[model samples]
Target chain A: MDPLEVEFLAEKETVKIIPNFSLDKIYLIGGDLGPFNPGLPVDVPVWLALNLKQRQKCRIVPPEWMEVEKLEEIPFSMGLTKLLLTHASDNIPKADEIRTLVKDIWDTRIAKLRLSADSFIREQEAHAKLDNLTLMEINTIRTFLLDSLNCMYKLRSNLQQGSSKGQFSNY
Target chain B: MSDALSDCGSDASHDGGQEDVMTPAELIEKLEEAWLNEKFSPELLSNRSEVVECVMEQLTHMEANLQRVKKGDAKASIHRMEIDRIRFVLSSYLRSRLQKIERFFPHVLEKEKSRGEGEPSLLSPEEFAFAKEYHANTETYLKAVALKRMPPNLQTVELLKAVPEPCLDSFVFLRVKEPQENILVEPETDDQREYVVDLEEGSQHLMRYRTISPLVSSGAVQLI
Candidate 1:
């Protein structure tokens, strides 16, 4: 998947936003969103929140995890942090600190991922645990990693005689 | 849009196995799952016409309602935005399928032809038609450009052998939705031995697509 598409998925995650105007409960296909009252916080998807912010109709309340200290426990995605920082940094407090902290977290996570990937390649493991790795992190190394795995598999398969062709399970 | 949609899809389902109603939200979830699975899987998955039809119905219904509302209503705009998001997903999902069909048309057609009398199809009706057309055009183009230049004995080309089949040994990242036991993990090389690992519910894993292809169609696991 493209990194942008991953960002698109992040936009669906709900965040608290304070609308500047009042509105009735809007029953949407996915779910209801509004009943927005002036100066009162309501939960909304980031896409809608960003749209409202662009119109100067609302103030985005960054998710709890966007804070510098709270970055460690974020349930949301790194792509989301970037999206919020890029689009609605004004609403988020200590934006620069959060940005730096987010970078730190991402760097640490990627570093750990590289370590694991190196070991995985060295050991020639069949499968690896995907615990706590964000989708984007996995995506970053997916192509290179899978290609290497396949190349190794092909080399091994050639060593064996009459290994059957891979079969796709029928639906 | 992110998850199960519980409020819509009261229409008759052609899938026939489950009489139980799938809510609109759940239908949406199903579509997204199918989308991602199709996107990541090396092979074309079975057609999900039920989800496609239901989602189309829901979109049509919501759109019909929007037509009655005034243009400037805040609710209408929000509804439009939601619809656009869903529409994007739906189209992306379909386009991915089309791309796969184009890539593996001969094998896909062969699979369809070789299936049993009552088995589920790999392609939807429209997709099947498109594949047939694509196959004819490709053959015509090949014959015109190169095949016709060959000796009569060598002119005949087998597309099934020519086109590379999807490699099921390719790895994928998946999340287990339903817990499963004794799922076999095949060895990658001669030195490593095959082993079975119990798939715990909600746990993610990186593994070969072939090992969990059945689990995917059964909705027991979702391809990330």
Candidate 2:
């Protein structure tokens, strides 16, 4: 239901993925899943895509030609993400709750970052401190913080509404 | 279209100019007329050259003012006219033309507004773009983690995006959980029996607190 489109690399078309959390499946927006590794190298990509759809009813479409350059080089966090997905499966309520909680928590963190940025900008305006930072730098920090918080807020709303297909947690 | 040109020419006469010294405004009108007529004329080229000079001078003036401001000397306030002029020159000409067209077609602007308002989360363009990007990157991060068999690390993640919300300084405290006292009282026994009551103690207080930041604005002001 959420209008966001998830783009990922796939073998044929650049698949637009949508997640169907209620059904525990991901419908390839324009296509479907292809052959991939079974181990940690490809689990998160598959599980994350599938679980996100199941929990949010959205899909994650791979971009074109998204091959694993090196199987051994995969990051550990992706595997951890898959583990969380596995643990939370079948308990849709818990999974959805955690997804919401993760996003809400991330939103709070972003708000804090924004507050820090605002303080920094105010100090710059008041004391005119550009000791180590350019005015643009300070402005950039402020912009980034605000942008992050706003983004998290959108995701939070989307998750709460159960229409966040193709949309990911802002965290 | 013929009538439109005559009207434009009459309007152009309001401004003071030499026989060929048309202002940028007149040049714009003439260019529009020419485009409508689908005729290429040598005069259009000359007119465009003059407009370019006016635009160049405007930008030079702004650059000088910015230099002064950057050096802590804010003597001159860059006026809006000069700013518009500079912008016209710097950005592609099509942008200005599109703006003019949009002005003529007011419904386009209204449609854009309606689309945004229709969304459940009324996020600004910048906010939506950043959020989408963050989601993508987060997925990328997850994929990276899975590939490497490494533990999830939040430190590498960059939370902020290029455009921040405007009202980011406001914050509110949220009570996540509240304490409640329970009293269990025993009621009457059956038929011909008497009634009795029992009471039990409950928690004095129990609650959890969370700081809620409003989604309406940035709500991220800091004191630095």
Tell me the whole-model lDDT of each prediction, alpha carbons only. Answer: 0.83, 0.31
Residue B135 in candidate 2 has what lDDT? Answer: 53
**Which candidate should be chosen as best, given DockQ against the real structure?**
1
B1-224: candidate 2 lDDT, tens digit per residue: 00122323333443233333444334443333323211111011111323334444435544654664544321222133224433533343333333332222222222334665433333324334443555566557756766346544632433232222122122111111222122121111122233222211221111000111211012121111
Stretches off by above 4 angstroms in model 2 are A1-48, A51-97, A100-104, A125-171, B1-224
- Candidate 1 residues lying further than 4 Å off, grouped into runs, are A73-76, A162-171, B1-19
Candidate 1: tens digits of C-alpha lDDT, residues B1-224: 32333333334244443635665666777788889899899899999887887789789889998899997998888889989989999999999999989888999999999999888889999999999999999999999999999999999988888877888888889998889999999886677789999888888899889899998888798988
Judged by whole-model lDDT over C-alpha atoms, candidate 2 comes out at: 0.31
Q: Residue B23 error for model 2, in Å?
A: 51
Worst 10 residues of 1 chain A by lDDT: A162-171
Candidate 1, residues A1-171: lDDT per residue as tens digits? 888888888888888998889998877767777799999999999899999999999999887767777786764587788989999999889999888888887888889888888888788776877868888888898777778777776666767855646433221
Q: Looking at model 2 chain B, report the run of 10 residues with the lowest lDDT sum.
A: B37-46
